[model samples]
Target: MIVETFNKEKRNSKTVELVCDLGITGGGTAGVCAAITAARKGTKVVLIQDRPVLGGNASSEVRLWILGATSHMGNNNRWSREGGVIDEILVENLYRNPEGNAVIFDTVLLEKVLNEENITLLLNTSVYDVTKSGDTKIESLKAFNPQNSTEYIVKAPLFCDASGDGIVAFKAGASFRMGAEPKEEFGELFAPDKSYGELLGHSMYFYSKNTDKPVKFKAPEFALKDIKQIPRYKAIGKDDKGCRFWWFEYGGRHDTIHDTEHIKYELWKVIYGVWDYIKNSGEFDDVDNMTLEWVGTIPGKRESRRFEGLYMMTQQDVINQQQFDDVIAHGGWAIDLHPADGVYSKLSACTQWHSKGVYQIPYRSFVSKDIDNLFLAGRIISATHVAFGSTRVMATTGLCAQAVGMAAALCTEKGMNPADILKNRSIETLQNELNIVGQSIPNIPINSKSNLISEAAMEVSSELEISEIPFDGDWFRLNISAAQLLPFKANQNYNFQLLVKADEATELEIQLRTSEKSKNYTPELILEKQTFSLNEGEQHINVEFLKGTPNNQYAFVSFLSNDKVSLKTSDKRYSGILSVFNGVNKAVSNNGKQVPPTDIGVDEFEFWTPHRRPDGKNIAMKIYPAIQSFGSDNIGNGYVRPWGEVNAWVADLNDKNPSLKVEWDEVKKVSEIKLFLDPDYDHPMESTLMGHPEEVVPFCMRNYKIKDLDGNMLHSVEGNYQTINVFKPEKPLNLKGFIVEAEHPSEDVPAAIFEILCQ
Candidate 1:
């Protein structure tokens, strides 16, 4: 429904309906990502930020360093590195001010929008009123700017509340909730047994440059009668790094956005008094002139309005790691709460869930329980007090907004409300989109009753591929275009190599090309070693892995290539989650390092392209790990290598037996090694299975054949069961390790499982 005249062409002879693909109110973490995502999808999007600049807490005032469940201890998650808006910021930081100490966060977002022709950004604007008809449709959203004293109405099929206060949801008559709930509601371990108004307090981040100098601070205007009783206010001697400042919570009584002026005033006094005490105390001995680092003029709020959605995620959902039928996001950060009327404290002990591995955030939480038309983003998504605490992190919030943007786009395309997309779009599809864009949805367990159309990284991107395709910008889709290489004939060796700029030890995407024809039957590349991670802007990781090949293939034949291969979980708790479900990259980076991240190990994998295909054309497929390296290895506890195809291939070695001769197909994978003593005991077929060890593990032999149900003998050498090019394929696939049935089904010594990327 969009009619466009190029900048030079004004051929609008006819009227065109400007269908807003997405209407995002509130330019915070969620709103920014949402708008950017929709714009990238070729949708006309309108972004409204009340502030002059974008970023709510992280920018407007620049809080710096985003927090996320993706590798906080030191590991970095490439998946969490969103494309669109978030990517723009990272790339800008990389070249403009790699140190990040002196970078303008708002400029980065502004640049991205200015460059994108589809997005219309409205700054210093607010959604004053919203109207909806029937149950699940938003008719118009009226935006007013006091600066210009103007008002404009926008009509969109979808609307998102990224205000962090659930502003749009509030005006749209959506169901919403505030404060904490009693323990009986969900019976979570950290519940209060009774409801209370306590929510996480807000903060203003400050950096310290004079760690060695003496700093001082005094009390504020607030009464301190029972200050000691306040849970988290204890100022341990070393509590105030560099200089100290206070930014407790407010807004419990009224609107947060409209009354931010009070917050700033309160912070200024709190800071001045705290500094007064320090300047006047003996604590000044170690310092010369106590310098005040920065104070948060813009507050970083922790709690706000939470809308009621189809599913209100509770602590139970987090505790049991419940699999949702419509998962759209994942969060692992602990639920962090602070007192509303207490001294220097956060209520982590009460509202927080023990950090197990990350869990999925449901799609049902995005829409409202009452006003079907309204969608929410950021900290305002549907959740019990405890649930919101876990997902309130900005990284996860960015994902929430990304999902909102995508869902809004879906609504416009199908002429439905976003709430319905929560149901209509299969959980698999939602999970796939998040994963393709690098958002975790690890809860699509096959064992659960939810949709089995399980989604992994739909089309894997990043270093997993053969070539790291460079873009003019930071945003790059985890996709490849092999058709562009069309007119390419079959049976040709179009090999490609992967090389990292080593500009910085950054987790990046590498893309190759492939078609959908050769997925289930291909051998993926494997890194021969592991990596030691470091964090100093950049490091050097030098290593390489050879490409793999499929078992058999004929020229001019069509095949399916795959985008991702699923990762298994490991056993061991880096966090509270089961060790098995952790990511592979984390294990690699943390493993086998003497000093760890200093003079570390390097794990490199480079897959090569095979020469031919069934149809006469060159074949190459993109490669990406099913899970981000931060995924579970599934091996659990420690490594338990699985039994591979028996080293032995079966054939009727009658030529050596003087009896009969037959060819055996090796395509059907084998898990155990079994040698028929050859009733006659003649030279046991030449292809005797050889493996890691004869007694400790199972190995394949060259001379063995499987009997099909039809009693027909299937040989390994004849290429019968199935053929795959272990080399490069055009289209990538979602692959797990081999699932083989051992000849001897023992209970304790189950078949050994090799890593998926390995043979």
Candidate 2:
């Protein structure tokens, strides 16, 4: 069906020319996200992946667990799951592949891409050549597929180098820097004093399976003579996998790209050596039955060449929690940097610094300065070494892909380049488009067009007047006070009540305050304070907001600790809320002496922690405003998951037929309807040490009915268990009102609907 010509050197000479709107190289996390996003937006996309499978490092070969804003549930960073496409993938995985199976996850990624009819996916195709029409424009790209021995030429208006190493940019003559930059170069506080070509290296991981009989591991000829060479080798267990061994690194002192083969060779030695030590060295004789099940042939890479862009993100931008006007994405991961020498270094494997909260990643970072139509996503995007340490993560980079993919679609529609979009002040349009697709941009509210419920009057059956939901999870401790952000008006005095349980008669202190600095969530100014003496058992206690409360926004109401008492919290955590906990770090430079005994668990506790406890146990507290459950404002707020407060349309548990009826002021034509249901965010859908949790969350609505006025059933959706559900009528529905009823809502708990959308 296809023909090819060979040159004098026997290389393929003929080219299969294909034209598309966007040509994306690489099939890694960022690349796949970019291709899928662009294709879904009606752009013709060409996704060229050099590997046989998608998901790059997350594929079965590498097997790295995807992590982003949540930062692996680290200290103080909670309720930060990445939104948009990543969230969709996670929710889907939770429903379909709860076992954390890599092969299944790969199929999910592949199906998402293939389902988009506008995408032309080419697997095992490597783009090795580029043609530049002028000094700044990319004319076309040349690629080869060894499996089929085919040579192809792809021409597109826009090209994205999602390739982890920036190969496309390198071939197109775009400026890029490899390895670490000097501290003085970008004024980066975490940069090395002297610039070096060394980079964070390549690593390989293997999986072990237990057998009924003892299995022997013979040392390969090239295996390391002594496993003690790695100081942290004692932590290795038979149950551990490659992901748990984040420090199994090598080849930072050498070229990570050009010498990949050499690096892979050395990694093999260590991987086998570690196994031999466990089985043969008498160090882990308990692993006598454990044998190697799977070994990674392709080493997962961390850092490589970083391309230059209009703006080079620096450490200051991250530490300051800068909010750029053109921000299209955000990152909450810590600035985790590994030594150039990696595992071979005498010092620890990594050094990390956390931000107060999620920080903005501007759109300027993805646009190339030298190339007119060239865009860079993934690890190659422009950023200082320290900043890259955080942005290089898969989830953050996937957000960048969504930004770039949306930008590329806009450029095609507007007949402009990346620079022109900025010049025309169309960045807001791009951001709005992103937000419409459920991407959360910090400080940017939802576009007014998609918020249809703003005008409708909402009704609920009843409210949780006195009873409180318990927020008990492993992440929450009895000693810490968890604060929920409740909405309050400026300069208004009000009464706030808390439903709490106590093991014995105890004293509790509550404080009303605001964030000391604009960037953090920790409470600072004490607007009102009160102490309560309570008896055992669950009871309601009232605290009053006297005066001087800031204008309408979230108020941080903190419930201080009584060791015998525990505040009832929702099992699920929400955003715009925070908790105070005891910290493990007691270093002097951390200003441990100055922090309030309760708030030191967070990165910026010192600025507000004035009260100290002699026992050194940080004061634990839960902060929130008065409960406004079942209020009319619940459905209008642009929050789906309960953050500081439970913002949702709820019906009383005792109601036999609870429903939320919304009547617009005038009859309107609706083409689409969407409902966001609560999936119990507290029960995370993640791959853990014990594998995946329950695939289906109990809180998700299983059966619901949609109807119009006069009790006319328009549609009935049953056995529904997704976080988000969409319905489109064959023709526009001319109606003045509609009612949503949860036929079989979760028992005992009130039926809840997060948001109702109509357009």
Model 1, clash count? 112
Model 1 per-residue lDDT at 640:
15
Q: Name the lDDT value of residue 291 in candidate 1.
A: 60
lDDT of 2 at 339: 75
Please provide, for model 2 over 1-759, each residue's C-alpha lDDT reduced to its tens digit, 9 standing for 90 to 100. Answer: 988686577554566889999999988889888888888789999999999999888777788777776654442333456667766776777777877877788888898888999999999899999999999999999999888888889999999999898899999999998877776777665675433234778878888889999887788899887877877777678678867776889988887889899999988888888888877876665787888998889999998899999999988788678879899988877677777766667666776666666789999999999999998999999998789988998888887898999999999998888877787679989987886666767767556577666777776555433233343432223464434444455565666555667788878887777654433444556777888888988777866667645555445666654567766544332222234432333211222212322321224442222111111121222334434454546676766654444566666556777777888889888887778776654333443222544566555677888889779998889877676788789999988988887753555355677777777
Predicted structure with the largest TM-score when compared to the true one: 2
What TM-score would every model get versus the actual structure? 0.54, 0.86
Instruction: Write model 1 residue lDDT over 263-341, tens digit each, in one string.
Output: 5565455445444444454454544445666665677776778888888898767644566777776665545544454
Candidate 2, residue 540: how far the Cα is off, in Å: 9.2
**Residue-level lDDT for 18 in candidate 2:** 91
The RMSD (Cα, Å) of candidate 1 is: 21.4
Residue 71 in candidate 1, Cα distance off native in Å: 6.5
